[model samples]
Target: MATTLLLAGLMLAQSAPAITVEAQPGLDQVGYQALSAGRPDLAIERISADPVMSASDPAALINLGTAYARTGDRTAALARYKAALTSRDRYDLELADGRWLDSRAAARLAILMLERGKALALR
Candidate 1:
């Protein structure tokens, strides 16, 4: 009985499951389409449901910020944009410097910021 109990304890310990974290879905082409189709609220809802969108993905954060901005939610837009800037990856800087980042995306962000009256001087 003692041996069986010991073996059972060992087996239980060995069988411990590994924890796995799921990724957010984040905004995709489909989401962008929805947003462009005058469905900002729906786009926001769908994008927000992405499991992988942590506070890190600038693209996702930017999209979310844009969605909020479209809805006239300046507070949420600013917060999301600030978060995106904070999480701005090497790619973002590269893009800003007009190096490796997508020209369209970089230009778009710059134009958007300027239009929004953000302090572009600091960037």
Candidate 2:
């Protein structure tokens, strides 16, 4: 159901990718791997290395923010999300199951931060 919603949301493209798929080389894989490896610091380093790239790829910015959030750094996480909001560029992320996801990084980050805060409060 969430995947379906993501597909529906992605039907609308605000603009073409800032960096073409071919141009990014292994960044996507590297970022994903870094995040999956419990190395949010590395993930943030790689993803935010290029501000332009991060600004363009919603996935990267979201991941970058996620990295920060995982480290309990809400300030940096929110900064990345706010930066993502400044641009209209959205990325079409193809999942392993062939589903595509695309959405507003800032909005997603807002929800994530809220959830993180709630989680902390409960603890």
Candidate 3:
């Protein structure tokens, strides 16, 4: 029974789709690191501190949205995601482990996942 359960768990893990968030070169690394470390409050504080940088950068918006989502602030998260979704700027956003995606596409995916109650999949 143990072997069977272990095999099943492995299979499930392997089959789960990998989730990725958009990254921006000019974004605040400290804020990004906070978000990645699962410290949403810290991420929000650091990101918000740089209003100039975070204001016009869609990538920063996405990161803020992700942080808000992590904190269960769906309204704030959705607002940020929506703002990012309308941006015309393009970026070589990192999607997965060594994989890249367009920033706009990443924002769309994040919004979809959040709306579908899969906000936990985002990070």
Structural similarity to truth (TM-score) of each candidate:
0.52, 0.56, 0.69
- Global fold similarity of model 1 (TM-score): 0.52
lDDT of each: 0.41, 0.46, 0.56
Q: Residue 13 deviation, candidate 2, in Å? A: 34
Among all windows of 10 consecutive residues in model 3, the one with the lowest summed lDDT is 1-10
Best by TM-score: 3
* Model 1, span 89-122: residue lDDT tens: 4232232223443322432453366355431110
Clashes of 3: 0
* RMSD, candidate 3, Å: 11.0
Regions more than 4 Å wrong, model 3 = 1-30, 97-99, 120-123
Instruction: Rank all candidate structures by their lDDT, best first, as comma-separated numbers.
Output: 3, 2, 1
lDDT of 2 by residue, 1-123 (tens): 011211111110221111111114344422555555555688778777777767665555555665676676778767666655554765444433456444453345344644545101000
* Model 2: residues with Cα > 4 Å off, grouped in runs: 1-30, 91-101, 109-114, 117-123
RMSD of each: 19.9, 10.9, 11.0
Q: 67, model 2: CA deviation in Å? A: 0.5
